[model samples]
Target chain A: MKRIEKVADMAKTSRILAAEGKSIGFVPTMGYLHDGHLALVREAGKENDVVIMSIFVNPAQFGPGEDFESYPRDLERDAALAEKAGVDILFHPSPEEMYPEESDIRILPGRQADVLCGASRPGHFDGVLKVLTKLFHLTRPERAYFGQKDAQQLAIIETFVRNYNFPLEIRRVATVREEDGLAKSSRNVRLTPEERKEAPAIYAALKDGARMLRESGDPELVLGMVRNSLGRIPDAEADYAEILDYPSLRPLSAESGEAIIAAAVRFSGARLIDNILVPLEGKTS
Target chain B: MKRIEKVADMAKTSRILAAEGKSIGFVPTMGYLHDGHLALVREAGKENDVVIMSIFVNPAQFGPGEDFESYPRDLERDAALAEKAGVDILFHPSPEEMYPEESDIRILPGRQADVLCGASRPGHFDGVLKVLTKLFHLTRPERAYFGQKDAQQLAIIETFVRNYNFPLEIRRVATVREEDGLAKSSRNVRLTPEERKEAPAIYAALKDGARMLRESGDPELVLGMVRNSLGRIPDAEADYAEILDYPSLRPLSAESGEAIIAAAVRFSGARLIDNILVPLEGKTS
Candidate 1:
């Protein structure tokens, strides 16, 4: 595997590979790689001739008082894991290299960014869109991979690509999870042993809530049930729990074809989020 | 020239040509086939293997009370002229095709858009950025061409591409003009015979102001002279006349490297604009 730190060199390398008719699958992550990130890379490796993974702990996506300073980063460890995960190119750019100059321009998110984690974290997805815009322009991949773990981000980015008519595909990989149903995340390591034991409840609640939503087709009832289920965890504060139309992230209606059961829980040391996409029993997704 | 009206077809055609190692030069314009539009196509033809010209009277760029309702469009005539200018592909998409769904997402401009024409037409460059985002994605050309006639738009777009790290290049084509020095514009056709006779003064004022700016190194003095020159035309109104730092479109200072002298004039039925890019004498541009 090859490692690149310069922005211009990565862009040139990707363009050269593209000119040679090689399909590139790009996976953009915020370093401190875990099984979730490697899962995306492995999927990219299976689908394209070259898999390019970018590790950028983008500061733009972090709001004031957010975990920007505490974000985990280990380049040496990440590089070794990425090589083992079949990544062909590793793009690790510093903050200065990614944002050389300050300009007021921004890629604002649409309606899809208003729900789930976005409700509590304002301007978060805008930062995500900004970084993706730069990364996509540099990579110019045939297909870009995203794990369902950050489902709101995946949906917003998919909408951006579709609305902007970007000539590439968004391939979504399923969220990697532990055998006990806890979502694989870099923050998972920060959980105390007791918090780790209770973390599995988040995914279990989503699973049960999706089933309830499919049967009742009532957003309010399913959401309340999810909140009640999350309330069972000791000292685990539910940041947000809601049901909305799948990718649009709008209010659910009778005509809605699909929905998402998503929740974010704040523990002592880390915050965890999980979601499940549900196709209505009688409606097409 | 091959004409494509559907958005998907144009994107696919461009991508196929790109995959074949063809460097595309894209020229986007609102069509009435003036020499100015053809000049951009001619420049695109010379620079790449395939020249793609899009004739879209983008409503996104026109604000309320603007000329969107009466903007000139002549597809058959434009197609003939584009072919004569050696354009390989001509893309003409309707407003509905371009914006199929309502999306609030926008690519907002920076300080570069807050001056000159943007001052009078609020949210104009936001629309410009929106459409250009879609157009640039669909037609991922090696280099995109713009006329210096709309110096503010060119500067804002150049900044957008640079700040976003878009892989494509921005090539500035010199403003195409008539023998009497009137900048070529579709709106010029609306000018009465008498108005036509006096229109050359717009460019004349810009040329004189550029020299004044260089000699005096004072923006206010040069802009006052431009306004005074435009005031000489009987029954005409000076919409705007100003000089500012080039590209960045910021306030001028002792450290400024280059500048632009731009003006817009309103006739009885038509509005015209022109500009001159001036490199400050002891500075590297």
Candidate 2:
């Protein structure tokens, strides 16, 4: 796979590929690849002539006192994994290369960012939008692949892409998980021996919460039940447990036929997030 | 020129042209076409295989009491002028078409949007950035054109495009003017007969401010001098007059290599703005 670092070089390569009538599928990620990222890459490869993946641990996305400083990175392992996954180009840009100067423009999001993971991580998705804007313009993909694991992010991006009439398609891939039902994530590697064993409970609580909410029709009770389940994990703090309208990420209502049961839990070293989509009684996607 | 009023149609046309390896040069305007807009269209025609002009009087860019409601628009005349200037396509989308839903995303600008015209019109550049972001994505031109009459806007756009690494070149077309030095603008139509006669003084004051600032080395005194000149017009009110570091839109300092002398004058029904760029003692562009 061809490796690129400079911003202009990536844009140039994409333009040349476009002129040659090659369809590019872009998958942007903060590196330290796992099965989840590879899932996006493989899906992109299946649909397009070329798949381009970006690996940059954006400092802007982490809130203050958050994990920006010690975010795990493994470029060598990531490059190898990306190549094996049929990625035609690996864009590995440093912090300096991606953000040469302080960004003055902010892509502030609205209600879609008010619930679930957004509550604790203020300005996190703003940074995500900023980097994605840069990456989208640089890569100029025909179709961009995003996993349902970052479901809120996927929804916000999909909304903006449609609202702004961005000249590309957003392809959603299902969340990749381990045999134990733990979601595959780069941060999973940061789990200690004991926390690693307990991680499966996070996904289990999400499933149980969705099943419970559909039956009880009481969101707050389901939220408390989900938080109670997550809090049982020793040495782990439950960050947030929420029931929001799916894709819209707003407070749920009866007419809203689709909803998401989402939660975040913080281990000593890593803060992991997970969610499940559940159908309501009335309307469904 | 072919006329397109739909968003998807414009995107499709641009994409088809791009697939044919045709470089598109874009000139985004607010209709009620004048010589200044034509200059941009003419310049676009000279550079690329396709010249696409958009006449969108974007409501997002107007403040609460601004001229958004009364903004001049003449689609029939604009189409005739655009075709004569060699425009291949004219994109004219309605406000509803452009913003079908309320925008939750805001492109908040930084210090670049805090002074001069921005001071009077708060959150103006945020709207400008929002609409331009949409246009830039939908049109996907190789190079976009902006007139230097709106010097602060030109500078802000240049900075953001560079900072964000937008995949297009920004061509700076010099401000087109009347024989009497009045800047050509759609708002000029709102000027009363007497106000029209007095409009030339705006540009004249801008010229004098730059010269006096160079000689006096006092921004405040130079600003007052320009405001005083503008205030002389019968039934006219000087909105703002100042001299500041060019492009950055910050207070001027000795080390700064370039500065701008800018002013606005309100005459009953119309508000006119003008500026002149001056070379300082050091660093040349």
Candidate 3:
């Protein structure tokens, strides 16, 4: 597998691929690959002639108090896993290489980014959109793969592509999970042994909430059940448990067509997030 | 020449061109054609296998009270002029087609857009950047052309492409002017006969200002000369006459490397803008 470190070199490679009419499928990620990231790469491999994976722990996406400095990264391990997963190219660029100077332009995400995780962490989606813009331009992939684990992010990116008329498709793979149903995340490594034990409850809460949302039409009752599920786990604090319309992430009404039950919980040293998309009556995808 | 009125058709055409390994040079403009717009198309024709010109008078770039409603458009004339200039395709999308819904995402231009014309027309460059982002992605040109007449717009776009690593070159064609030295602009039609006669003073002021800047290193003196030159014209109200550093558009000092003398003048019925770039003692491009 070819490894590229410079943006210019990446663009050159993509152009050469374009000339040969090779369909590139890109998987952009921060290093410390988990099954979730590998799942994206695997899907990309199945769908395209070439698979390109980018591992850059983008600093712009992290806030000043966030884990920008301490984000997990292991290039050697990530490279081996990516190669095993059939990635043709691994783009690992330095922070300076990705952003040589402060950006004079930024992507301002719309109202969809104002709820759930966005409320807790402001400007996070903006950073995600910005970096993705750069990566999409550099890679020029026929299709880009993103995990449904970051559901809001996937929605925002999907909206950005549609709104800007980007000539590419965004393929969303289901979230990869541990046997216990906990969504796989790079931040999962930061969980202490006790915190790890409690992490599964976050997903359990989301699942129960989804079930409640399907059964009962009352959003408040569903939210209460979700909060109660998280409350049962000692030291697990619910950050947010929201029943919002899918994709748009707006507050869900009884008549809302489709819904997503999403939750974020704080477990001592780590923050975990999970969600389930609930198909409304007579509607399924 | 093929005329496309839909974004989907335009994207398909660009993709077909890409598959055939044909280089596309794009010229994006408002519908009212002038020599300046033709010059960009002419340059694009010379440099690529296909030249695509898009005539879109973007509403997003105009303020509420601005001339968006009154923005002059002559599609028949523009189409004829573009065909004569060797344009391969003319994309004329309606505002509703360009923006089916209010954009959920937008590009917020940075400090470079906060001065000169930007100060008077808030969110102007933001709108420009947003439309260009959509157009650039849809057209997927190997090279895009812009006139140096809108120097700040050209500079901001160059920075946008650079920052995003867009896989295309931005070719800045020199400003095309009439024999009387007035820069060719679609807005030039709004000028009365008497106002049109005095419109050349805007360029004259810039030229005289550039000469003054080259002779004397003092920015204040150069700016005064420009303002005074514009003041001598009857019914001409100087909107802004300032000497600022080029590209950065910051306050100029003796140590500033490259500089621009930009001015906006308001006539009885029309507003005109012009600028001149001056390379300092040890710098030349």
lDDT of 1 by residue, B45-75 (tens): 8889999998898988898888998877788
lDDT of 3: 0.89
Docking class of 3: medium
> Per-residue lDDT for A158-276 in model 2, tens only?
98888767778999999999999999988888899899999999999999998998898889999899989998999799988888888888788877878898888999889999999
CA displacement after TM-score superposition, residue B197 of candidate 1 (Å)? 1.4
What's the TM-score of every candidate structure?
A: 0.97, 0.98, 0.98
Tens digits of lDDT, candidate 3, A57-126: 9888888788888778789999999999899999998889989988868898989889988889999998
Q: In model 3 chain A, which range of ten residues has the least summed lDDT? A: A276-285
* CAPRI class assigned to model 1: medium
True-contact fraction per candidate equals 0.74, 0.70, 0.77
Candidate 1 residue lDDT tens string, A112-181: 8777788899999989999999999999888999999998999999999998888899999999999999
lDDT of 1 at B185: 93
The predicted structure with the larger DockQ, 1 or 3, is 3
**Candidate 2 residue A83 C-alpha distance from true site, Å:** 0.5
